[model samples]
Target: MTSAAGATALVLALNKPVYPLYVWFLAESAFHLSLLTALTMPLYLAVWHLSRSGKGRAARLGMVIVGIVDTLAIALILGGESETLAFLFACLMLAGLSFYRSEVWLSRGLVAAIFVLFVALEGRIGAPLMPVEEDDMRSLAFLNVTGAAALAAFIMLRFPRAERPD
Candidate 1:
């Protein structure tokens, strides 16, 4: 998830004809991705260990917290971007991934929506969803990066390795 976010940032940054704030964009992307991993990995590992040791309650609690954080972050970022369809897709996907035993359906739905959105946006199927503001672009980038980090943390915490007794 962090990789996806960073890649998206990088792609957006490079899509511009002129390279302004190129270095900042790349640096922030990397920093956010790494920060996300750093914050989430240990908790995921700990949850896995706890579950393997038969501490299901604590693991579940941790997962709930993860879910809350992920939902909030994604909501903030997508809302900030004014990507309503994407936000809906993200919310559904996150909910399914967090709560459902089978997440394949949710994944498929999100993928399809994302593909359609990408194509539509590229082809200008409708008016721009959000106004493009040059000054706000940098701030938007920062919000997205932070939101992506939060999302990555949630994903890692929610879908940890299955616990198996040795």
Candidate 2:
């Protein structure tokens, strides 16, 4: 997605009326979408830079764009930026991929709890994050919780069970 499209989608998803930080700014959906892209500068840059593989630049760019857009969509709709739900979930996804790649599950409880929390934050008991003027916090929480749990499970399944060495 072009940055603007992502932003416009995000603004609509999060702030449904979909204007701007300032109403007087006078911009189109395209403009708002661009803002969203600009808003996720750090994440986009990091993804674009870090992902170096046989995969070409276009692949990296596509993945980075997709990841950021999905992430922000999840964030704005569920937890608002302040909740940092996006960052946490992103970390969890990366961590799971890394740790599971190596087969480890020392952090099972943490992952489980995080999963539960993500789910709970969403639809259930749902309300938009405080000060966001919306209502979907429950859904956000629940999803985060679920994501965390899934990561934990992935780790547990991939890694060897912990046992004392005799």
Candidate 3:
């Protein structure tokens, strides 16, 4: 849950005012990617809390739903503009699985698959799904990507250290 909160704060704080605007604008404009991404936050929080409360199976189900939505969002939003977001979503999904499921190998296998996909996609040419943005915004978006990945990694790797109810 801390990872979720930290990732949320990092995303919103770093982008400051514009991130919300971007989200709102994309939502209002009916851009599926942005809308879905924004929607995933609350669902993720729910899953996190549920897992913390020992409703692991429920949490895992919610995580799967979120992952599916994220996958659709990425496909609908395709291109370089969606790259960072795609990776972030993958990280979040894998982290959730690792944290909530007893089957660790499944999560690890998915991680390996992600790595393979990235390696396979290397050097592929692509265009932005949305219009090219100002440099500052681009850099900030990249920060969100890296920040999300870091938080997900922390959450998964430190799973054993998380507080557990007696």
Candidate 4:
């Protein structure tokens, strides 16, 4: 892709973090997950292309967009009085996307911050932290997202990036 195309793609990654918000938190219907994931197809494809030979601009922008989107989505959800498990779940996936696109400490840090904020907001607000008695799947899904984020951070730390020159 050309530099401009790559740059735009990178910018679009900003929306990647919005996925898990619906997937993990707010989605009550199967349609929600399928629908939101479908919406994110372009975001992931752009990431894939950037991670290839699309150059530094695209890759960096993609990583940044991924981080910012999750943060923004959470803030919006939290402030709007709609902080559901589905939204948090979507944010978690967005963190994982950040983990994949850029091997940066900030990427991992953003996820960690979001996690803390998520837990704090929910607990402080009396939102359900644990699943209902029979909702083991939801519980497992939360743990899985947590595990994936840690793994992603470990990988990123182990493989530091070379600083690009301006």
RMSD of each: 11.9, 12.2, 6.8, 9.3
For each candidate, give its TM-score against the true structure: 0.32, 0.30, 0.50, 0.37
lDDT of 3 by residue, 96-126 (tens): 4444346666566655655555555533525
Q: Once superposed on the true structure, which residue ranges of model 2 sit more than 4 Å away at CA?
A: 1-34, 53-95, 100-103, 106-110, 124-166
Best prediction by lDDT: 3
Model 2: lDDT of residue 153:
52
TM-score of 1: 0.32
Q: Per-model C-alpha lDDT, please?
A: 0.39, 0.39, 0.48, 0.44
Poorest 10 consecutive residues of model 3 by lDDT? 27-36
Query: How would you encode candidate 4's per-residue C-alpha lDDT over 47-159 as one tens digit per residue?
Result: 55776774654554454454345434433333222333334444454444434344556557756766776676653443223222224335434543553455345434433
lDDT of 2 at 6: 30
Q: What is the lDDT for 72 in model 3?
A: 44
lDDT of model 3, residue 40: 48
The digit string of per-residue lDDT tens for model 2 on 80-133 reads 422435334643443333332233452354346446655664433332233332
